[model samples]
Target: MGLSHRSAQSHDHWFVTERDELHRSDAIELNGRSALNAAGIDIDDVVYLDLYSCFPSAVQVAVNALGLPLLDPDRPLTVTGGLTFGGGPGNNYGTHALATMTETLRKDPGAVGMVTSNGMFLTKHAVALYSTTPPRDEFRVTSPQLAVNARPRRVPTEHYSGTVQLETFTVRHDQQGLPERAIIVGRTGDGARTWSRSSDQGLMAALETEDLLGHSMRMADGHVEEISAVSREGLF
Candidate 1:
């Protein structure tokens, strides 16, 4: 399945969007679940899945939303390996995924396949279910955004400075595949979200060594410092 730019504003090259304001994981899950329901199939009936793998979290979020096992031997997440190994091909990656899924389903008639597509940093999502066997009802498309739009939104701080709690983050790598920098999304004491980047080699290495999804840190003068994970005892 393919997903196009939702609006002219989202047509830009930015990582964030101005639409429903749903988290990528929530948006993906909504679209995926709706698609399965429209196709009159359950998640367990899907024999194949081609999840959009722009990043590890993109796939992880979808998996979590779909309630699928992280590592299923019989139903591995990808049919074309993934974005990197399968060739990202920019916005056309989903096309390749659909083509791959079609071929696989043809090999095993009556087997159902699901393909997911993402646009612009997971801002837009689309999922398509296919099978050799016809559905009990005619195929239909559902809009998950309607439900997502009703949820509350977390306002982001543009010029945030001070202590913050990490919500989620991703580490960038150099051409040689070594850790280079980190892009972090954090929440301030007031619940405002902020995005910051850190290039400190030592800090980046430490981040790679541990799971710091809820870690806290301080930002000052465009530098992220004082990295520490949240303790179970409610201490930082």
Candidate 2:
């Protein structure tokens, strides 16, 4: 069964269903599982997946949701390379993904494939499952918002000034392929989250070589001050 976001209008469209069938989740893993359950299938049954590849983290979250290894060489993550390689067509990229998945499932009859789409900074997610064979029962879709709502949310502090641990980050580059700025999301000592940007050329250069996830850093006056790696023993 295929899935898409429901529109506000009450138009009776095949792709746009009831709000209950329209699911939205910030957690990619939960979103993936919810889509699978709605389609009446398991992770093992899906032979193909086209994860939303706007960024690396999006792909990582989907991989985590499917309980797949990070470095699995057997399963290719993308059916059409990826957004960078396959051309990101703004909000309509998922359409291309679904088309590619459809062609793939047609060639490999009886096999199941999944396509994931994201809208607006990983905040919106939609997963669709397809197969050559028809389902025994009528296809049904579900909303995973309840499950996602029940999960704890990280409270963010606007002006946090203290030690923090890096949660995840991304570096933006310019057209010339040079590092431009770093967008960082971190958790303060009190468990509050904070987002900051760093344009320090030296720091950006250092971040390229370091695995900064979970690393300790200090923020002051709304700026990242110092960064340090967390030792294995220290973590324990």
- Best-fitting candidate, scored by lDDT: 1
lDDT (tens digit, per residue) of candidate 1 on 1-236: 32211111111113352322324456666776677666656789888888889888888877987788989999999999998888856577877887888788888888888877777666667777787776666556667676656545676776577988766677999999998888887777876777788887887887788877667888774357777765522323
Output the lDDT of residue 96, model 2.
Answer: 81
lDDT of 2 by residue, 1-236 (tens): 33232111111112211111112234456666776666666778778878879878778766775686666667688888887787766677777888888788878888888777766545666667788787666665556666665555556577679888776677899999999999877776766678889999877887887777778888996689988866422321
Query: What residue pairs are clashing in model 1?
Result: none
Query: Number of clashes in model 1?
Result: 0
lDDT of 2 at 161: 90
Total backbone clashes of candidate 2, pairs 3 or more residues apart or in separate chains? 0
Please give the RMSD of candidate 1 to the true structure.
5.4
The ten-residue window of minimal lDDT in model 1 covers: 4-13
C-alpha TM-score for every candidate:
0.74, 0.74
